[model samples]
Target chain A: MRILPRTAESGSYAALAGLAPKRRPSLTPYYFILPYLVFFVLFRLGPSLAGLGIAFTNWQAVGTPRFVGFANFEAMARDPRLGDAFQNTVFFVLLTVPTLIVLSLALALFLNQPRRGRAVGRVVVFMPYVIMSTVVGVLWTWILDKDFGLLNVYLNFFGIANVPWLVSESTAMYGIILTTVWWTVGYDMVLFLAGLQDIPHELYEAARIDGARAWGVFRFVTLPLLAPTTFLVLMLTIINSFQVFDQVYVMTSGGPGTATLTLVQYIYTTSFQFQKFGYGSAVALILFGILVIVAFFQIRGYRRGLKGVE
Target chain B: MSRTISRAAWYVLLAVVVALVLAPALWMLSTSIKPEREIITTQIRWIPQNFTVEHFQAIVQNYPMMQWLFNSLFTATAATLLVLVLDSMAGYAFARMEFRGRGLLFMIVLSMLFVPIQITVVPLFILFSRLGLTDTYWALILPVGANVTGVFLMRQFFLSIPGELEEAARVDGASAFRVFWSVVLPLARPALTAVAIITFLSTWNSFFWPLIVTRSDSVRTLPVGIAQFLSLRAGMVQGQMSIGQSMAGAVFAALPPIIIFVILQRYFIEGISRTGIKG
Candidate 1:
């Protein structure tokens, strides 16, 4: 629990670097951060680079790195599985992000009310978010069971047939989407709830004084203020939605003929399950590129919105 | 009148949302308690008619659940502790210190957050396989030790504090580490707690890393074990198991984060709120 406060008297950063005390006692910060960095480079950056290397070479995990440049990427271009994975991953992001944002904002509104049970409700809803994805998959499997699940059993009175929630390709991704929404909405709700609390009461009163209706206040006032949080959550949700490996692995295994096969899942299969390091690495790098581009567009949109505000 | 109309609509919407969210969880709980006959029944009942705890009793009595619980709890705790110490130190340096390459270094680490956790899986496997670290707790704890969020978080939090406190301490001839340990770390409680809660929860909930690393039930954590339980083709338990056992596992896995949040709900919100917005 040591902290090193480098005493830099000069205002300039360069001056601080030269003028600060030589003995940085918490130089331990470097060491403190060392373990993580070592692992990061080794596990994260190393493999990612190795993955890049492997992509260029026909390197399986067990084999020599014989160069077969551009072949893996070319194969990816032709691979129908890669194409399906891309579509499904995009579909997953599309389905989950909007629903998550909507549900989170709605719940945040509910929990924002200064009511007796509001706190309790907030904690309860947030409970699911904290659970492991593995546990979530199992719980949903039982709950969404076609013959034995609560969903179809409840639907029995309406004379609806039992839906093959995770079995059929058409419905399979939907099941994953629904499960994802339930699991992650609470996290965003908490964020939005925090954002809502930050909005001053004076704005609402001011809107009312201007003869603004509830919807008017929400549209003009609340929505504008919540944009920052919405932006952040939306960006995170898109990233997280694309990175759906654990649930797919646990629940569907990208199954029922590749309906739920996300790009990351494909990467997983190639790397670990199929043992094609080069192929997996190339797919991973592409997925990484896609995510980076998506992140850029989102931030661009956010910046554009911010510019409008300014 | 408008208030009344909107309020009614709000209630209906909230009701539907709550039902949609709670139905799966409630069903898991119900199925957990119901007998195999009741579970497989065509009729839907919210309350289990059989209401048996046999599955729970079996999970506890028949399985090595206690070990799994201990393993998950201890590993998560250890990881959180290490992260707090190291992350805070690095965070303080990145925020307060006039270190070389600090901004660029911080940017690199921050960008790495988007590196899909899956990207690291292979090299880690290769690395651990070489290190002979497989099946050990160190394997589970080390790779995830350096959390970019924690470092970024600590740095931001330190910057927010009035610098005069550190100035005052340093004037009194306090060393940097001493200043951070005694004066700064105590003040960063809210931020530290935020990092700790998320860290512990994620660590506890981690399945993929541990699944790849640990060999058997002896070293495996709760989530992986439960996943194995579901995927088990062994001894095809025809009517031998019930939903209760899985629910109990879910309850075990889910309850800790809920309780931790209950204990520190304010800090929990503060943590998430700060994560993205802060530069």
Candidate 2:
């Protein structure tokens, strides 16, 4: 874990310069990594660092950002819109993550078994993941279209009344969640399937021979083995749910009156639509901070679970 | 026996799950082929009564679907190739090279992965505007020339490459680059292919950046074009007929990713599965 290379290695690199020894490996790495490094710095690093500065300024997208140290953050502390975005974002994370986790796990477990037509089922389940969020938004808009939506149509077929799916604030978030779950669960399922594959069959057989019930085997063998995949999926689901912008932008446009305006969509609208770059950076910074916290916990949880380390 | 009933229940439950998953996709296809009137009709039909290829034909007739296809192909392929070559070299250097600040530089490089594409959008737009590179290929390609995921993957791959082979090459008087090309590159095919497929798909499926960067249809790629066409309908089914025509367009949009995924499935899954290392 030494940060720098040994002096002996450094001298060797110098001596082996002309000979171009692969072991000494030249300054070639710097030359090689330059393209990606340059772009990464220019695009990802530059904007992020600039945005960090903007969080403390009064940038308005068109002019010089006057330094207003912590004013944006202070404004964000009392901003009603940010509060709503945060509330809605938290609700979305809470709502979508659990549903996606349970449903995807159930689907994955179902497909994990050697059943008939499992391959067809898996591929079919995975199809929605391939479509664009815009398309998913559009398709679901029609399907949940209050007047002509297939759901309302089906409900009527069963003697139910017409329900405004996306028009109502209460139902709108549900519509987004439903669309997201159906469209996304397959990806988590695929990850789970890979995890399920890694679980040795003989372990199940051994448990079966020892007179363990199906539930017992799943609890003891399957769950423990699949925890890593589940953890990864949970991590993804939480990140995705928090950063839920596309569906909001596409489906409801963050309405029926700001019911589904997620943190990301809010940040997006703040900068682009409202052109409040400084406040937007504050929002972005808050999101960044929240993600960092979530990531820290997730990493800690993963390591503690995997290595039993504190 | 209860076994028969249980089996039937499992099948039925799975049937429902499959239906839920495929319904939107099938709906997309169904709408794409449906004739104009049928789409607007109050009638709710799972399968279209009258299907036509009009939408596909319309795209072919009025729009530069072919040009869009070519742009997507050219950009994705070129970007994938560039990422592969550049990423692999950098990966090898970082993993194997004994140099100053190598580890620190790599940590910095990889840290860029945490910065979501959205954070970069506004500044990049400004930067590209200043460079007057907007609407051009550089606007599209240059910014993504070196992806962090590709570098991370390639570096991991290089670490796994046997140090003895590298030492053997040096012992045999082979140049560093020579050993990399001859010994390292060939052996890193599986990793390279994984990197290639993932890179290709990401580039192909890239949306916000391409939409922001490209000014007109001549440069606009499939995702943006499809978004434009879809959004023109403005989240409505105005131009759509019988769901079949729109379905056809949806199918067309999703086809390349499917074909590529199927062709390079092993690499595709591996690449995706590994790309979540931070997660």
Q: Mark the regions of model 2 whose C-alpha exceeds 4 Å error after superposition.
A: A1-25, A307-310, B1-13, B59-67, B232-248, B262-267, B276-279
> Candidate 2 residues A103-172, lDDT tens each?
8888889987788978778777765776666667767777787776777878898888877878888888
First chain of candidate 1, TM-score: 0.89
> What range of 10 consecutive residues in model 1 chain B has the weakest lDDT sum?
B231-240
The regions of model 1 sitting more than 4 angstroms off are: A1-36, B1-19, B232-244, B276-279
Per-prediction DockQ comes to 0.45, 0.40
> Per-residue lDDT tens digits of candidate 1, residues A257-285?
99888888788788777888778877887
Q: In candidate 1 chain A, what residue range of length 10 has the lowest lDDT sum?
A: A1-10
**TM-score list, all predictions:** 0.91, 0.88
Per-residue error for A270 in candidate 1, Å, reads 1.6
Top-scoring candidate (TM-score): 1
Among these predictions, the greatest lDDT belongs to 1
